[model samples]
Target: MADEDNPDSGGTVIGYERELADITGAIDRYGTGAPSHIAIVAEPMAGRTTLVAEIRRIYGDRVNYLPLEFVIMDSTVLDCSTYEGDIILIDNCQFLSTRKIGGFDVLDMFLRTQITSKKLFITTWNIHSWQYLCSVMNLDAYFPTIVTLNRMDMPVLKQVILSRYKPGEIRFLDEGVAERSMFFSVIHSTMRLPFTSAEISVPWIKLNFTLMLRKLPRKKRVQISLEDVILEKINRIAYGNPGVALMLWDESLKDNAISLSAITETPFSISLDTNESFILSVILSMESLHAKDLAAIAGSEMDIDRVIYRLVQQRLVRDNAGYYSIEPFALGPVTDYLRKTRRLW
Candidate 1:
């Protein structure tokens, strides 16, 4: 495959490029002198992991990736003096937020260790948690560098999709299949600015684009690139959630052409009338509650366990500290409905 044909090669590296450059510079500055830690703050789905992967690609074995997701240790585990490395990449530091053990504390401890030792620390966080910590705990002093992942524009999104298609990956679409206007429409709608997190958003964009292209009819189909259609839909409905968008597009592929109606009818589609109502109710009852609390709230009227599980799947709510709460953006409608109809007060 030509270098550009590889999506990873020509993908949306723009946003993180400068940040990574800065990190590399920081590492070079401190790699031999002293330990330095950098914190990367982005919205969920904004593309943190990909950026990290890119960093690893650039740094190779010199960087030690300590993904926080799999680490079951608490706040104090960060304090353990046994850890020693030249570079530390800690992804998903926001997980510490829910533990009431903010990433700041963990990062603080880690940085303290790095200062005396010889290691570079880099961490990623969900933007929401970053702001919350900044406000509640004055977390700004912890990191000298904070990189926020910006969403891709039309051109970048187009490049990202087209780059994924090898001449042989699909025998369908014509060359230069993505149209500018259409591409703009799709990316603008699908890719959100100041993303909730790149870790959540990038995979979503990549997956949705691929799934959408595959669904195109081989011949006598829409002349438009499957990339365009998927991007458009992703722009329209998916926004911060590429996962849901991809899954919905997969459903549309059953018939080879997806319509808004088909999208609404998909089983995973969040039905405003039915599912949204239940989610709103549960969220209103428990502000910042965990998954089980959501189950408990809905348990009296509906299948609490099932509802909480589905809510998590829908991304309408999330589990923090074994508790569940509605996503920040989703809180308004849920709160309004609860006040008016459910009498949540």
Candidate 2:
């Protein structure tokens, strides 16, 4: 679907109408007598900052925004007893704690202050960190209104990308090659014999070839535009994160043109042992960490060098100076794998 109505508009919040409305409604209710506290949870580069910006744009003076950067500031900033605004917006709440023991003291203090204060608090959290906190401390119980962002669907994803460019400004190239392919596979299994003198299990040896073919296109002209198809692929690779999708678009665009083949997808079948997965989870939660810090988090039982070497060999991570981080394109797949295995929490 083409977003012709708002073709010239860029940087507008897309696919978050319901979430915006819920947040605004909470603030409005707070103004009248209801006590409201909200928690906006999303993955990194999943548009938490964008949604907060939109809130600031709408509320203007009524909102007092406090962006927390824990790398520089510590728990002392959580002493919000002096804040005067009726509605307080805190971004990056994940910075309140670390992986070390007793690191959640800041979060505990903040929760205590929030419960006593009359002001409505709206906070944003990194999804992975939030999951960990939820599992460890039952953090979600404190926020009466929690809004978790869902991944964008294809139509909304198309609208978001198209809104960034003018009509026909970016060329969508098609190589004319097949959009998909087919393959065949063979399988072997064990079976039980039923008609024998006595029922027995035996190895089933048979020539079994299964053919899987890609769905062919309809005889009629395609309904979706080439740009839409490219955007769809980009969104798929990005796992529906708008910011990641935009980054992919920039990386794939060449000479003001983008092709279906230009957008690459990270291999989803990457295998990682438990130690590597734990180390990756730590790195992802912290963005980048030194080897010593990683080792500290991974504990002495783990051989950090071997795990790091394996991760580096797989191209899932990169080392900068003495720090390591997930590769840019690999973030989506790595995060998905960690989440699937329940290691991110």
Candidate 3:
């Protein structure tokens, strides 16, 4: 079998070529007398984790990869006094600290170690946590190289998903929903400026909202195929998140086949008290946390069990055994809510 046909090899490397160049360039510079630490900033499904994997694939054992799957306690964090490769890659570095008083102690110690040690560090962070830390701890000053994984456009998103399969492998079954103009609708896009983290609103594409205002009966239907429509819907809902798009594709596909109507986007409606909102925001920043860590971040006053119960009841968070995190479909709504409530910086 061809390598491209294998799903394990599929990645958004094409979309991330520029970012890969920037990071690899930083690593190359590390060999010089002037070495620089780097940080990869992105949301959960934004492909930063994939980029980290690519880095590990390239450098092999030369780079030490430490992926933080859950919240890290103070006793477990490395002081950087010990041994490892000269290059260190830490994924999900947001777990380095929590959002409470004295919570940043571990992060402070880690930063101090990084400052004194000569090891080249490449770390990844959840964007919300990174922003909060930037404001509160001045984290921007620690890393000279910061790579924010920008959202991809429709074409790039399409390419990344399609590249996962061999040509003509999966059949696209059109369910005849071509009349709706979902792709070129007048929706405003949130465009983030590179490096500066500034954002602006731009119309994605201009066209009829739903084509529901047609006065006369159309003589012929639109020529758009079911494949295009499905891709467009996936792109719109995923909002340029490659990982999320892939997940939706897998969820929609049945027996190696897909239809335009098979893809459904779940809209989220959330209302929570201050403590619940705060705890949810912490989970978002840290990705996932156990009950103990959540309670630690929630502090003494907030009833951790009650807050978790409310969040779970609302379907805003999912409990995998003991680890708690925002539901995949609720990611957008939860982020918006936290941002609006000033819970996230």
Candidate 4:
């Protein structure tokens, strides 16, 4: 059967059988004359692009895809010229709505369009944006269906990585090693906060790392276990972000290793106990604080410059503009620690 007739057949749509089924079912009900679009949310490298590709392959040209990235403009001015179709896959729709622009207004208008027009639209957004949209702005009402792609579990992640290796080379992943690597991979993935831009897929970091690994001397390959190094570095640099991991791995080949030492080698590590307390205090006490504010909070004991610098580097906090705030998720840990130490309310 041609893809459009089936709407759920593709290699890229692996492990998402349920999501596919739900989408196709929705399409079948609403897609014949006009389609209803959905929102597919996932962390970076969680395979949003692949999902869009699968949707396109299944729906064929019946679906028009507009991949949105950093260039998210207002819906009022959006030119949907090439977007006339039964199904529209809007990848990285998060760019359209963020804290910078009044994302709520944009999302509100976009959702209104989906309802007024029977266009079956599937949008993929960063988890952060989705949370802000749904929780902060109460925009979840606009989305009839929402599917969140969580971190890949060990077994699944192992299967995903091993699948990339050819049958012959795949045997190199000793039983325990694959599982162990995946464990770390998942841990690394959780460290980086979730994002929603489906511009790339799982194998995003493939060739870059492989080409670099191949450059090693045959002797070093045997001694160092390139696979382990690759997994470790990929786990760290990309934080299980297949795209970023692959890119960093490739760059490492050209550049140098991005090891923990290299990351810490920067001249300082944030004094966790003291610095975290001070920083959190500043954030909680003030209406809003920036990196410079963090420096002030650190007082003379620690340099605010270094405190913000290190926290951002470690992914403990996010600095948007000059505003330095702990990442939304990371706040849990920081808050818990501070409370335990009698920091704040």
On TM-score, the leading prediction is 3
**In the order shown, what is each candidate's alpha-carbon RMSD?**
9.9, 11.1, 4.0, 11.7
Between candidates 1 and 4, name the one with more favorable TM-score: 1
Candidate lDDT values, in order? 0.52, 0.72, 0.78, 0.54
lDDT of 4 by residue, 1-345 (tens): 112123455564545566678777877888465444577877545566666777787778787778653434458544454576767778777656544334356767777777677667778876545655666666566666666665443234445555544554432332222222322232412222358422222322223444354557875542445355445644443444444443444443323323332321011232465765666544533313555434543557776676666677777667778876555434435444655676553
Off by over 4 Å in 4: 1-12, 32-35, 76-82, 100-103, 171-345
Q: Write the per-residue lDDT of candidate 3 for residues 153-214, one digit (tens) a residue.
A: 66667778777688999999967464355636434456777987454446566554233334
**How close is every model to the real structure, measured as TM-score?**
0.55, 0.78, 0.86, 0.54
For residue 210, model 2's alpha carbon misses the true position, in angstroms, by 27
Candidate 2's TM-score: 0.78
Ranking by lDDT: 3, 2, 4, 1
Clashes of each: 25, 0, 0, 7
What does the lDDT read for residue 146 in candidate 2?
A: 78
- For TM-score, candidate 2 versus 3, the one ahead is 3
RMSD of 3: 4.0
* Shift in Å, residue 314, candidate 1: 8.0
Q: Give candidate 2 misplaced runs (Cα > 4 Å).
A: 1-12, 32-34, 71-73, 176-224, 288-295, 303-313, 319-324
